[model samples]
Target: MSVKIEKAYILKSFVINESDRVISVLNEKGEKISLVAKGGNRLKSRFQGKLEPFSFVKVEYFDRGKGGLNSLNNVELLENLQKWIKGDMKKFFALSFLNEVTDRFVYEKERNSKIFRLIKHVIDSLKDGVDLKLAISYFSIWMLKLSGVLSEFNEEIQCLNEILAKPLDKLDCKEPQTIFNFGLDLISKNSDKPLSSADMLKNLI
Candidate 1:
C-alpha cells in the first residue's frame, strides 16, 4: 500500500505480453530488484526510452510485501549511457558482461554500496575513452575483492591499493591483464563457474 522511491541502474529488461515490461535493476546500494512496468512497451508510455538497460534512473514503486512483483509507478532518468553503448561494440559487450555478472553476484535486497560505486566508476571510465581492456580488468579485480575471493598479490599490492583509492582518470596501469587474470582465478575458485563473459572477452583480446 505504501510506495518507495529508489535510485537504480537498469540491468536487464524485456517485454512481457504486449504492453508491459519486466525489468531487473541494481539499486544504489547494490541490491537487485525486479519491477513490472505496466504499459511500458506502449508508445507514449511514461517509461518509454527511459528504462533502457544500463541507464540510471529514480524509480517509484509499490512493494507487494509478500514476495510478489513490485508495481512500477514512475521512472525519472538520472543518466543515459547510450554514448558508450553505441560507440563501440567491444565496450558494449564488456559492459554487458559486467552488468550480467553483477546481477548474478549481488543478492536481492542485499546492500553493498561499495560495489555500486565501483560499477559506476568503471562505466564512467569506459565512457571517457579509457582503454576497454583496462577498465574491464579493473572492474574484475574490484569485483574479486568485493566477493572476498581475491587471492594475495603481494607484488602488485601497492598498485592495487592505489587503484582502489584513486579515481579512474588518475590511474596508470600498464598491464591490466595480470590483474584481470588474478580476478579470473578468484572467480573460478568462488563461483559456481567462471562467468560466461570471460570467454567472450578472451576472444576480443
Candidate 2:
C-alpha cells in the first residue's frame, strides 16, 4: 500500500458499523475521495471530532490501489464551519444546498481546480458573513460555467456576464433572488436527480 496526504474539505461522512465510518471529501485537487476511518465512531477515537462535514483538514491515509477502501490514519483540522453555520437555520440549509450541489457535480478522481477554488472561496465568503443569496448565486453560476453548460443561458441573460466578472465576495446584484432562482433552475435541469436540499432551502427562505 502507498501513503498519501491531502488537504481536503469534508463533504460528508457515513457510519458503517459500531466503530467505523466512511468519509467523503473533496481534496485540493478537486477529486472526491472516500476513506474508511476505523474506530471513528468510538468516544475516544482519534477522528472523533475531526471528521465533521465542512471542515478543512489535512489527512493521511493508506491507498490500497483499486478494489479496496483507503484506510484513514490521521487527520489535522484546519478549519471548521459547523460552529458558524449551525446556529442559524438559513445558513445551515444554504450550506447544505451547496454541499449537495458539490457532491452531485464532482466525480471521483477527476480534478477540476476551478471548482475546488470556487468551493473554497465560497466557504471563506460564508465564514466572513457574506449574504447567503450572493454566495449561492455565485457558486451555482460558476459550477454551470465550469461544466461547460452555461453557454446555453448566456445570451438570454446579459447580467450573467457581470456576475461572472466579479469575485464571490465582491458580487452584488440588485435582484439577487431573481439571479439565484435563474441559476437554481438551470442547475436542477442539468442535474441527473433533483437536489434534496433545494426544498429545505426554499422553505427556509
Candidate 3:
C-alpha cells in the first residue's frame, strides 16, 4: 500500500498496550482521523516525542480505506507545542479542553476550513503569549462561531454595551444568572451569521 503523508495536529492519544499509541489527529484537511503508531511509546520510539497530544507534525501513514484505523508508516517532527504546554498550566488545561472539543467537532476526513483555522489561530495565539483567561474566552467564542453557535450580534451587542456600562454593583443587584443568560440568548440567536471576533473581545471587557 502506498503511504499518504499528512501534516496533522495531535489532539488526543491513548496508550495501546505498552509500546504503541492510538492517536486522533486533526489534519490540514480539517478532518480528524485515527492512526496507530506502532512502538510509539518507548525510549527510542518511531514517533519519538512527536505523537504527544497537541503536537503538530508531518505524519506518514497508509490509508486503509475501510475507515477503521489507518496504519502509520513513519512520523516527522514539526511543532511539539511544548512551548505552550510546558509554560502555562492554565493554558495547558485550556488546550486539553479545546483539543477534546475539536476532536468531537471534526469527523473522519470531513473538511471544514473555518474550524481548522479557528483552532490553529487559537493554538498559535497561546504559543505567542496570549493571556490565559482572555485566550480561553476568545477560544470559546471562536469555536462557537465555527460550530455555528455564534452569529452577528448587532442588537445584542448594543444591549451588552449598554448593560455593561452600568456599575456592576448597581445593575440588578440581585441576579448574576440574568447576565449569563443574556449572553447565552445572544449566542443562540446569532449563531448562524458570521460572528465578529472583535465583538466577542469587546464583550469580554
Candidate 1 weakest lDDT stretch, 10 residues:
150-159
What is model 3's C-alpha RMSD? 9.0
* Tens digits of lDDT, candidate 3, 1-205: 5678988888888887888788898888787889998888788886777788878888899888775689888888787776746675555566765675676556677787666666787677666765444444444545555666534433433333433234222233233334344544454344444334324433543
CA RMSD per model (angstroms): 2.4, 1.4, 9.0
**What TM-score does candidate 2 get on C-alpha atoms?**
0.94
Q: What is the TM-score of each predicted model, taking all chains together?
A: 0.86, 0.94, 0.70
Candidate 2 regions with alpha-carbon error over 4 angstroms? none
lDDT per residue as tens, model 1, 1-205: 6799989889989998889998998888788888999999999898989888889999999987767889999999999887657776687678777887787778777789888898888888877888777777677777777877545644544457766677777888766777666655555456665677666777775
User: Local distance difference test, per candidate?
Assistant: 0.79, 0.85, 0.64
- Model 3 accuracy (lDDT, Cα): 0.64
Q: Which 10 successive residues of model 3 have the least lDDT summed?
A: 167-176
Error of 3 at 172 (Å): 26
Q: Candidate 3 has which clashing residue pairs, if any? A: 150-191, 151-190, 151-191
Ranking the candidates on lDDT from highest down gives: 2, 1, 3
Best by lDDT: 2
